[model samples]
Target: MSDKKKEIDLEEIIAKYRPVVGFRVKKSLGAANPDWEDVANEIMLNVVEKIKKGEFRGESSIGTFIYTITSRRIVDYIRQKSKVLRHAPEPKPLPSPHEQIEDKERAELIAGAIKKLKPKYRETLYLYYYRDLSRKEVAQKLGISLRRVSERVNYSQKLLRKLIKK
Candidate 1:
Protein backbone atom coordinates (compact mmCIF):
# COMPACT_ATOMS: atom_id res chain seq x y z
CA MET A 1 0.00 0.00 0.00
CA SER A 2 0.97 3.56 -0.60
CA ASP A 3 2.28 5.66 2.35
CA LYS A 4 -0.77 7.91 2.48
CA LYS A 5 -3.16 4.96 2.40
CA LYS A 6 -1.19 3.15 5.12
CA GLU A 7 -1.43 6.24 7.36
CA ILE A 8 -5.24 6.28 7.03
CA ASP A 9 -5.51 2.55 7.68
CA LEU A 10 -3.33 2.89 10.80
CA GLU A 11 -5.61 5.52 12.33
CA GLU A 12 -8.69 3.34 11.70
CA ILE A 13 -6.91 0.31 13.15
CA ILE A 14 -6.03 2.27 16.31
CA ALA A 15 -9.65 3.32 16.82
CA LYS A 16 -10.89 -0.25 16.46
CA TYR A 17 -8.07 -1.82 18.51
CA ARG A 18 -8.33 0.61 21.46
CA PRO A 19 -10.63 -1.53 23.58
CA VAL A 20 -8.75 -4.78 22.98
CA VAL A 21 -5.46 -3.11 23.73
CA GLY A 22 -6.75 -1.63 27.00
CA PHE A 23 -8.09 -5.02 28.11
CA ARG A 24 -4.81 -6.81 27.33
CA VAL A 25 -2.68 -4.25 29.24
CA LYS A 26 -5.00 -4.01 32.25
CA LYS A 27 -5.19 -7.81 32.50
CA SER A 28 -1.43 -8.30 32.39
CA LEU A 29 -0.25 -5.31 34.49
CA GLY A 30 -3.32 -5.12 36.73
CA ALA A 31 -5.68 -2.11 36.85
CA ALA A 32 -4.22 -1.13 40.23
CA ASN A 33 -0.81 -0.46 38.59
CA PRO A 34 -0.53 3.30 38.12
CA ASP A 35 1.26 2.81 34.78
CA TRP A 36 -1.45 0.70 33.11
CA GLU A 37 -2.76 3.61 31.07
CA ASP A 38 0.78 4.50 29.99
CA VAL A 39 1.55 0.89 28.92
CA ALA A 40 -1.74 0.65 27.00
CA ASN A 41 -1.05 3.96 25.29
CA GLU A 42 2.47 2.79 24.43
CA ILE A 43 1.16 -0.40 22.80
CA MET A 44 -1.32 1.53 20.70
CA LEU A 45 1.36 3.98 19.68
CA ASN A 46 3.64 1.10 18.66
CA VAL A 47 0.82 -0.45 16.58
CA VAL A 48 0.10 2.81 14.78
CA GLU A 49 3.78 3.56 14.16
CA LYS A 50 4.65 0.03 12.95
CA ILE A 51 1.62 -0.10 10.63
CA LYS A 52 2.51 3.28 9.17
CA LYS A 53 6.08 2.06 8.58
CA GLY A 54 4.79 -0.93 6.47
CA GLU A 55 5.73 -3.42 9.21
CA PHE A 56 2.21 -4.98 9.17
CA ARG A 57 2.87 -6.63 5.71
CA GLY A 58 -0.87 -7.34 5.14
CA GLU A 59 -0.31 -11.02 6.03
CA SER A 60 -2.05 -10.70 9.42
CA SER A 61 -5.19 -8.84 10.37
CA ILE A 62 -4.82 -5.56 12.35
CA GLY A 63 -6.11 -7.32 15.51
CA THR A 64 -3.38 -9.99 15.47
CA PHE A 65 -0.68 -7.39 14.81
CA ILE A 66 -1.80 -5.28 17.79
CA TYR A 67 -2.08 -8.41 19.97
CA THR A 68 1.51 -9.39 19.27
CA ILE A 69 2.81 -5.88 19.95
CA THR A 70 0.90 -5.62 23.26
CA SER A 71 2.15 -9.00 24.54
CA ARG A 72 5.81 -8.26 23.77
CA ARG A 73 5.64 -4.72 25.24
CA ILE A 74 4.16 -6.08 28.47
CA VAL A 75 7.00 -8.63 28.81
CA ASP A 76 9.55 -5.86 28.29
CA TYR A 77 7.84 -3.66 30.90
CA ILE A 78 7.92 -6.41 33.51
CA ARG A 79 11.59 -7.14 32.85
CA GLN A 80 12.39 -3.44 33.24
CA LYS A 81 10.40 -3.12 36.48
CA SER A 82 11.95 -6.23 38.10
CA LYS A 83 15.61 -5.18 37.63
CA VAL A 84 18.00 -4.89 40.64
CA LEU A 85 19.50 -1.64 41.91
CA ARG A 86 23.32 -1.51 42.23
CA HIS A 87 25.14 -1.09 45.58
CA ALA A 88 27.41 1.90 46.32
CA PRO A 89 30.67 1.91 48.34
CA GLU A 90 30.83 3.60 51.77
CA PRO A 91 33.12 6.67 52.21
CA LYS A 92 36.24 6.76 54.41
CA PRO A 93 36.20 8.41 57.86
CA LEU A 94 38.33 11.46 58.81
CA PRO A 95 41.85 11.06 60.32
CA SER A 96 42.37 11.80 64.04
CA PRO A 97 43.96 15.13 65.19
CA HIS A 98 47.06 13.30 66.53
CA GLU A 99 47.74 11.82 63.06
CA GLN A 100 47.46 15.30 61.47
CA ILE A 101 49.99 16.82 63.92
CA GLU A 102 52.48 13.92 63.53
CA ASP A 103 52.25 14.17 59.72
CA LYS A 104 53.03 17.92 59.89
CA GLU A 105 56.02 17.39 62.26
CA ARG A 106 57.46 14.57 60.09
CA ALA A 107 57.20 16.75 57.00
CA GLU A 108 59.09 19.56 58.79
CA LEU A 109 61.89 17.17 59.89
CA ILE A 110 62.30 15.81 56.34
CA ALA A 111 62.40 19.36 54.89
CA GLY A 112 65.10 20.47 57.33
CA ALA A 113 67.23 17.37 56.58
CA ILE A 114 66.97 17.97 52.80
CA LYS A 115 68.13 21.61 53.15
CA LYS A 116 71.28 20.52 55.15
CA LEU A 117 72.54 18.10 52.42
CA LYS A 118 75.48 19.40 50.27
CA PRO A 119 74.53 20.76 46.78
CA LYS A 120 75.75 17.66 44.81
CA TYR A 121 73.78 15.17 46.96
CA ARG A 122 70.75 17.47 46.90
CA GLU A 123 70.95 17.73 43.06
CA THR A 124 71.30 13.95 42.72
CA LEU A 125 68.29 13.28 45.00
CA TYR A 126 66.21 15.98 43.28
CA LEU A 127 66.86 14.45 39.84
CA TYR A 128 66.46 10.79 40.92
CA TYR A 129 63.46 11.15 43.26
CA TYR A 130 61.58 14.43 42.72
CA ARG A 131 62.10 14.69 38.95
CA ASP A 132 61.84 10.87 38.51
CA LEU A 133 64.95 10.57 36.30
CA SER A 134 66.74 7.18 35.92
CA ARG A 135 70.11 6.82 37.63
CA LYS A 136 71.88 6.80 34.24
CA GLU A 137 70.01 9.98 33.23
CA VAL A 138 70.90 11.70 36.52
CA ALA A 139 74.60 10.72 36.04
CA GLN A 140 74.66 12.04 32.43
CA LYS A 141 72.94 15.30 33.45
CA LEU A 142 75.33 15.85 36.37
CA GLY A 143 78.47 14.74 34.39
CA ILE A 144 79.06 11.95 37.00
CA SER A 145 79.50 8.16 36.79
CA LEU A 146 76.50 5.80 37.29
CA ARG A 147 78.23 4.28 40.34
CA ARG A 148 78.69 7.80 41.78
CA VAL A 149 74.96 8.56 41.29
CA SER A 150 73.93 5.35 43.18
CA GLU A 151 76.37 6.07 46.02
CA ARG A 152 75.19 9.69 46.38
CA VAL A 153 71.48 8.64 46.55
CA ASN A 154 72.11 5.92 49.18
CA TYR A 155 74.46 8.15 51.26
CA SER A 156 72.06 11.09 51.13
CA GLN A 157 69.21 8.85 52.41
CA LYS A 158 71.44 7.71 55.37
CA LEU A 159 72.44 11.32 56.18
CA LEU A 160 68.78 12.48 56.03
CA ARG A 161 67.81 9.71 58.48
CA LYS A 162 70.60 10.71 60.90
CA LEU A 163 69.75 14.46 60.63
CA ILE A 164 66.04 13.80 61.21
CA LYS A 165 66.85 11.64 64.27
CA LYS A 166 68.88 14.55 65.74
Candidate 2:
Protein backbone atom coordinates (compact mmCIF):
# COMPACT_ATOMS: atom_id res chain seq x y z
CA MET A 1 0.00 0.00 0.00
CA SER A 2 1.21 3.55 -0.88
CA ASP A 3 0.31 4.65 2.66
CA LYS A 4 2.62 2.08 4.23
CA LYS A 5 5.32 2.79 1.63
CA LYS A 6 5.19 6.54 2.20
CA GLU A 7 8.51 8.42 1.98
CA ILE A 8 10.22 9.49 5.20
CA ASP A 9 10.11 13.28 5.39
CA LEU A 10 12.40 14.60 8.18
CA GLU A 11 10.75 18.04 8.48
CA GLU A 12 7.36 16.46 9.08
CA ILE A 13 8.95 13.95 11.41
CA ILE A 14 10.61 16.79 13.40
CA ALA A 15 7.37 18.78 13.60
CA LYS A 16 5.47 15.78 14.98
CA TYR A 17 8.21 14.45 17.31
CA ARG A 18 10.03 17.54 18.64
CA PRO A 19 7.69 18.23 21.54
CA VAL A 20 7.68 14.62 22.81
CA VAL A 21 11.47 14.33 22.42
CA GLY A 22 12.08 17.65 24.16
CA PHE A 23 9.75 16.66 27.01
CA ARG A 24 11.48 13.30 27.43
CA VAL A 25 14.92 14.94 27.38
CA LYS A 26 13.95 17.52 29.98
CA LYS A 27 12.33 14.87 32.17
CA SER A 28 15.24 12.43 31.97
CA LEU A 29 17.96 15.05 32.19
CA GLY A 30 17.03 17.60 34.80
CA ALA A 31 16.45 21.20 33.73
CA ALA A 32 19.41 22.12 35.93
CA ASN A 33 21.81 20.82 33.30
CA PRO A 34 23.08 23.71 31.15
CA ASP A 35 23.57 21.34 28.20
CA TRP A 36 20.02 20.06 27.89
CA GLU A 37 19.32 22.05 24.73
CA ASP A 38 22.46 20.64 23.07
CA VAL A 39 21.33 17.12 23.98
CA ALA A 40 17.92 17.68 22.35
CA ASN A 41 19.60 18.95 19.22
CA GLU A 42 21.81 15.86 19.09
CA ILE A 43 18.73 13.64 19.33
CA MET A 44 17.07 15.54 16.50
CA LEU A 45 20.19 15.23 14.34
CA ASN A 46 20.38 11.48 15.01
CA VAL A 47 16.73 11.04 14.06
CA VAL A 48 17.30 12.94 10.83
CA GLU A 49 20.41 10.90 9.95
CA LYS A 50 18.65 7.58 10.61
CA ILE A 51 15.72 8.60 8.43
CA LYS A 52 18.02 9.67 5.58
CA LYS A 53 19.87 6.36 5.89
CA GLY A 54 16.55 4.51 5.39
CA GLU A 55 16.82 2.85 8.78
CA PHE A 56 13.06 3.18 9.23
CA ARG A 57 11.52 -0.05 7.89
CA GLY A 58 7.89 0.79 8.63
CA GLU A 59 7.63 -2.33 10.84
CA SER A 60 6.40 0.26 13.37
CA SER A 61 4.80 3.64 13.06
CA ILE A 62 7.08 6.69 12.72
CA GLY A 63 5.92 7.83 16.15
CA THR A 64 7.07 4.60 17.81
CA PHE A 65 10.43 4.61 16.05
CA ILE A 66 11.01 8.23 16.98
CA TYR A 67 9.97 7.48 20.54
CA THR A 68 12.46 4.61 20.81
CA ILE A 69 15.28 6.73 19.40
CA THR A 70 14.44 9.62 21.71
CA SER A 71 14.36 7.35 24.79
CA ARG A 72 17.71 5.72 23.96
CA ARG A 73 19.38 9.07 23.23
CA ILE A 74 18.20 10.43 26.56
CA VAL A 75 19.56 7.39 28.36
CA ASP A 76 22.88 7.81 26.57
CA TYR A 77 22.95 11.48 27.49
CA ILE A 78 22.24 10.72 31.15
CA ARG A 79 24.86 7.98 31.28
CA GLN A 80 27.50 10.20 29.69
CA LYS A 81 26.74 13.02 32.13
CA SER A 82 26.92 10.63 35.10
CA LYS A 83 30.19 9.18 33.83
CA VAL A 84 31.80 12.63 33.74
CA LEU A 85 30.57 13.30 37.28
CA ARG A 86 31.93 9.98 38.54
CA HIS A 87 35.47 10.63 37.31
CA ALA A 88 35.65 14.40 37.69
CA PRO A 89 38.48 15.56 39.90
CA GLU A 90 37.34 16.85 43.27
CA PRO A 91 38.22 20.50 43.98
CA LYS A 92 40.80 20.80 46.71
CA PRO A 93 40.59 24.39 47.93
CA LEU A 94 43.07 25.54 50.54
CA PRO A 95 42.19 24.55 54.09
CA SER A 96 41.10 27.56 56.20
CA PRO A 97 43.34 28.87 59.04
CA HIS A 98 41.12 27.36 61.76
CA GLU A 99 41.26 23.97 60.01
CA GLN A 100 45.05 24.14 59.93
CA ILE A 101 45.15 24.85 63.67
CA GLU A 102 42.78 21.94 64.38
CA ASP A 103 44.92 19.55 62.31
CA LYS A 104 48.07 20.52 64.25
CA GLU A 105 46.29 20.05 67.61
CA ARG A 106 44.93 16.65 66.54
CA ALA A 107 48.43 15.52 65.49
CA GLU A 108 49.85 16.54 68.87
CA LEU A 109 47.08 14.69 70.72
CA ILE A 110 47.66 11.55 68.65
CA ALA A 111 51.41 11.74 69.28
CA GLY A 112 50.79 11.99 73.04
CA ALA A 113 48.54 8.91 72.94
CA ILE A 114 51.21 6.97 71.02
CA LYS A 115 53.82 7.84 73.67
CA LYS A 116 51.60 6.43 76.44
CA LEU A 117 51.34 3.00 74.73
CA LYS A 118 53.49 0.10 76.06
CA PRO A 119 56.91 -0.32 74.37
CA LYS A 120 55.93 -3.44 72.40
CA TYR A 121 52.60 -1.98 71.23
CA ARG A 122 54.28 1.30 70.33
CA GLU A 123 57.12 -0.35 68.41
CA THR A 124 54.78 -2.70 66.56
CA LEU A 125 52.67 0.28 65.46
CA TYR A 126 55.80 2.15 64.36
CA LEU A 127 57.12 -0.73 62.26
CA TYR A 128 53.72 -1.69 60.79
CA TYR A 129 52.40 1.79 60.16
CA TYR A 130 55.29 4.32 60.10
CA ARG A 131 57.69 1.97 58.34
CA ASP A 132 54.84 0.42 56.28
CA LEU A 133 56.04 -3.09 56.97
CA SER A 134 53.80 -6.10 56.24
CA ARG A 135 52.54 -8.03 59.30
CA LYS A 136 54.84 -10.93 58.35
CA GLU A 137 57.80 -8.54 58.10
CA VAL A 138 56.94 -6.91 61.45
CA ALA A 139 56.61 -10.34 63.03
CA GLN A 140 60.02 -11.38 61.72
CA LYS A 141 61.66 -8.09 62.85
CA LEU A 142 59.99 -8.24 66.28
CA GLY A 143 60.86 -11.98 66.75
CA ILE A 144 57.17 -12.80 67.36
CA SER A 145 54.56 -15.00 65.69
CA LEU A 146 52.29 -13.40 63.06
CA ARG A 147 49.25 -13.84 65.32
CA ARG A 148 51.00 -12.13 68.24
CA VAL A 149 51.96 -9.21 66.00
CA SER A 150 48.37 -8.87 64.79
CA GLU A 151 46.96 -8.97 68.33
CA ARG A 152 49.36 -6.31 69.59
CA VAL A 153 48.60 -4.03 66.65
CA ASN A 154 44.82 -4.36 67.11
CA TYR A 155 44.91 -3.99 70.89
CA SER A 156 47.25 -0.97 70.64
CA GLN A 157 44.92 0.77 68.17
CA LYS A 158 41.93 0.15 70.43
CA LEU A 159 43.80 1.51 73.45
CA LEU A 160 44.95 4.57 71.53
CA ARG A 161 41.41 5.27 70.34
CA LYS A 162 40.11 5.00 73.92
CA LEU A 163 42.89 7.23 75.23
CA ILE A 164 42.30 9.85 72.51
CA LYS A 165 38.59 9.97 73.32
CA LYS A 166 39.36 11.10 76.90
Candidate 3:
Protein backbone atom coordinates (compact mmCIF):
# COMPACT_ATOMS: atom_id res chain seq x y z
CA MET A 1 0.00 0.00 0.00
CA SER A 2 1.00 3.60 -0.56
CA ASP A 3 2.24 5.74 2.40
CA LYS A 4 -0.84 7.97 2.21
CA LYS A 5 -3.16 4.97 2.58
CA LYS A 6 -1.20 3.80 5.62
CA GLU A 7 -1.45 7.24 7.22
CA ILE A 8 -5.24 7.39 6.83
CA ASP A 9 -5.60 3.94 8.36
CA LEU A 10 -3.33 4.79 11.25
CA GLU A 11 -5.20 8.04 11.84
CA GLU A 12 -8.47 6.16 12.12
CA ILE A 13 -6.96 3.86 14.73
CA ILE A 14 -5.67 6.87 16.65
CA ALA A 15 -9.12 8.47 16.60
CA LYS A 16 -10.63 5.31 18.06
CA TYR A 17 -8.31 5.49 21.06
CA ARG A 18 -8.37 9.27 21.41
CA PRO A 19 -11.28 9.57 23.83
CA VAL A 20 -9.94 7.05 26.33
CA VAL A 21 -6.34 8.38 26.21
CA GLY A 22 -7.50 12.00 26.33
CA PHE A 23 -9.70 11.39 29.34
CA ARG A 24 -6.86 9.67 31.19
CA VAL A 25 -4.32 12.43 30.50
CA LYS A 26 -6.78 15.27 31.09
CA LYS A 27 -7.89 13.92 34.42
CA SER A 28 -4.26 13.91 35.58
CA LEU A 29 -3.94 17.64 34.72
CA GLY A 30 -6.89 18.61 36.95
CA ALA A 31 -9.28 21.44 35.94
CA ALA A 32 -8.77 25.07 34.78
CA ASN A 33 -6.19 24.25 32.11
CA PRO A 34 -6.54 23.43 28.39
CA ASP A 35 -9.61 21.42 27.46
CA TRP A 36 -9.45 17.65 27.09
CA GLU A 37 -10.32 17.70 23.39
CA ASP A 38 -7.57 20.19 22.65
CA VAL A 39 -4.96 18.18 24.54
CA ALA A 40 -6.06 14.97 22.82
CA ASN A 41 -5.90 16.61 19.42
CA GLU A 42 -2.41 17.92 20.08
CA ILE A 43 -1.23 14.52 21.32
CA MET A 44 -2.66 12.79 18.25
CA LEU A 45 -1.11 15.37 15.96
CA ASN A 46 2.28 14.92 17.59
CA VAL A 47 2.11 11.14 17.36
CA VAL A 48 1.07 11.32 13.74
CA GLU A 49 3.93 13.63 12.86
CA LYS A 50 6.44 11.44 14.69
CA ILE A 51 5.10 8.42 12.87
CA LYS A 52 5.52 10.15 9.54
CA LYS A 53 9.13 10.99 10.43
CA GLY A 54 9.92 7.31 11.24
CA GLU A 55 10.60 8.20 14.86
CA PHE A 56 8.47 5.44 16.33
CA ARG A 57 10.96 2.64 16.96
CA GLY A 58 8.31 0.07 17.90
CA GLU A 59 10.01 -0.68 21.21
CA SER A 60 6.73 -0.28 23.11
CA SER A 61 3.08 -1.10 22.66
CA ILE A 62 0.86 1.44 20.88
CA GLY A 63 -1.04 2.19 24.08
CA THR A 64 2.16 2.71 26.05
CA PHE A 65 3.52 4.95 23.32
CA ILE A 66 0.42 7.11 23.40
CA TYR A 67 0.47 7.34 27.17
CA THR A 68 4.15 8.38 27.31
CA ILE A 69 3.80 10.99 24.58
CA THR A 70 0.64 12.41 26.12
CA SER A 71 2.24 12.60 29.54
CA ARG A 72 5.38 14.32 28.22
CA ARG A 73 3.36 16.83 26.20
CA ILE A 74 1.29 17.72 29.25
CA VAL A 75 4.45 18.14 31.35
CA ASP A 76 5.97 20.32 28.65
CA TYR A 77 2.87 22.51 28.64
CA ILE A 78 3.00 22.93 32.42
CA ARG A 79 6.71 23.75 32.36
CA GLN A 80 6.29 26.37 29.64
CA LYS A 81 3.49 28.10 31.51
CA SER A 82 5.39 27.90 34.80
CA LYS A 83 8.51 29.38 33.22
CA VAL A 84 6.69 32.51 32.13
CA LEU A 85 4.96 32.92 35.46
CA ARG A 86 8.16 32.30 37.48
CA HIS A 87 10.16 34.81 35.45
CA ALA A 88 7.60 37.58 35.58
CA PRO A 89 9.60 40.62 36.73
CA GLU A 90 8.50 42.85 39.53
CA PRO A 91 9.05 46.62 39.39
CA LYS A 92 12.03 48.00 41.29
CA PRO A 93 12.97 51.50 42.39
CA LEU A 94 15.61 53.31 40.34
CA PRO A 95 19.16 53.54 41.58
CA SER A 96 20.44 56.81 43.11
CA PRO A 97 22.82 59.10 41.17
CA HIS A 98 25.76 58.10 43.47
CA GLU A 99 25.01 54.41 42.91
CA GLN A 100 24.87 54.99 39.18
CA ILE A 101 28.21 56.75 39.23
CA GLU A 102 29.75 53.90 41.22
CA ASP A 103 28.41 51.37 38.73
CA LYS A 104 29.92 53.37 35.86
CA GLU A 105 33.30 53.46 37.56
CA ARG A 106 33.18 49.71 38.14
CA ALA A 107 32.37 49.09 34.48
CA GLU A 108 35.23 51.34 33.42
CA LEU A 109 37.64 49.43 35.65
CA ILE A 110 36.49 46.15 34.17
CA ALA A 111 36.87 47.50 30.64
CA GLY A 112 40.42 48.65 31.37
CA ALA A 113 41.31 45.21 32.71
CA ILE A 114 39.80 43.62 29.59
CA LYS A 115 41.96 45.83 27.43
CA LYS A 116 45.08 44.56 29.17
CA LEU A 117 44.33 40.98 28.03
CA LYS A 118 46.01 39.44 24.95
CA PRO A 119 43.93 39.69 21.77
CA LYS A 120 42.85 36.05 21.84
CA TYR A 121 41.78 36.25 25.49
CA ARG A 122 40.18 39.68 25.07
CA GLU A 123 38.13 38.71 21.99
CA THR A 124 36.97 35.47 23.60
CA LEU A 125 35.82 37.26 26.75
CA TYR A 126 34.13 39.99 24.75
CA LEU A 127 32.20 37.58 22.54
CA TYR A 128 31.31 34.87 25.06
CA TYR A 129 30.56 36.91 28.19
CA TYR A 130 29.89 40.45 26.98
CA ARG A 131 28.02 39.45 23.84
CA ASP A 132 26.31 36.55 25.69
CA LEU A 133 27.00 34.00 22.98
CA SER A 134 27.04 30.32 23.87
CA ARG A 135 30.38 28.50 23.77
CA LYS A 136 29.40 26.73 20.54
CA GLU A 137 28.33 30.03 19.01
CA VAL A 138 31.55 31.71 20.10
CA ALA A 139 33.54 28.92 18.51
CA GLN A 140 31.64 29.35 15.25
CA LYS A 141 32.15 33.12 15.25
CA LEU A 142 35.82 32.92 16.20
CA GLY A 143 36.69 29.94 13.95
CA ILE A 144 37.77 27.74 16.87
CA SER A 145 36.77 24.51 18.51
CA LEU A 146 34.35 24.42 21.47
CA ARG A 147 37.17 23.18 23.71
CA ARG A 148 39.42 26.06 22.64
CA VAL A 149 36.72 28.57 23.42
CA SER A 150 36.26 27.09 26.88
CA GLU A 151 40.01 27.23 27.49
CA ARG A 152 40.17 30.85 26.39
CA VAL A 153 37.27 31.81 28.62
CA ASN A 154 38.79 30.11 31.65
CA TYR A 155 42.27 31.54 31.08
CA SER A 156 40.82 34.98 30.40
CA GLN A 157 38.91 34.96 33.67
CA LYS A 158 42.05 34.08 35.58
CA LEU A 159 44.10 36.72 33.75
CA LEU A 160 41.44 39.37 34.25
CA ARG A 161 41.29 38.62 37.96
CA LYS A 162 45.07 39.03 38.24
CA LEU A 163 44.99 42.29 36.29
CA ILE A 164 42.07 43.72 38.25
CA LYS A 165 43.74 42.94 41.57
CA LYS A 166 46.55 45.40 40.81
lDDT of each: 0.85, 0.83, 0.80
Model 3 lDDT on a 0 to 1 scale: 0.80
Q: For residues 83-164, could you state the per-residue lDDT of candidate 3 as single tens digits?
A: 8768884354444689779988988988899898899888898898889999999999999999999998888888878887
Steric clashes per prediction: 0, 0, 0
lDDT, candidate 2, 21-128, per-residue tens: 887787877655546667888888888888767788889998888889888877887787688878894354454589789989999999999999999999999999
Model 2 segments more than 4 A misplaced: 1-8, 89-166
Q: What is the lDDT of residue 71 in candidate 1?
A: 93
Candidate 1: tens digits of C-alpha lDDT, residues 1-166 = 6778877876787788888889888899776565777899988888877876778886887678788999999999887766621344335445568977999899998988999999999999999999999989999999999999999989999999999888
Q: For every candidate structure, what is the RMSD over all alpha carbons to the true structure, in angstroms?
A: 26.2, 17.8, 17.3
Ranking by TM-score: 1, 2, 3
Candidate no. 1 TM-score: 0.48
TM-score of each: 0.48, 0.47, 0.44
Question: Residue 107 of candidate 1: its Cα lDDT?
Answer: 98
Worst 10 residues of 2 by lDDT: 1-10
Higher-TM-score candidate of 1 and 2: 1
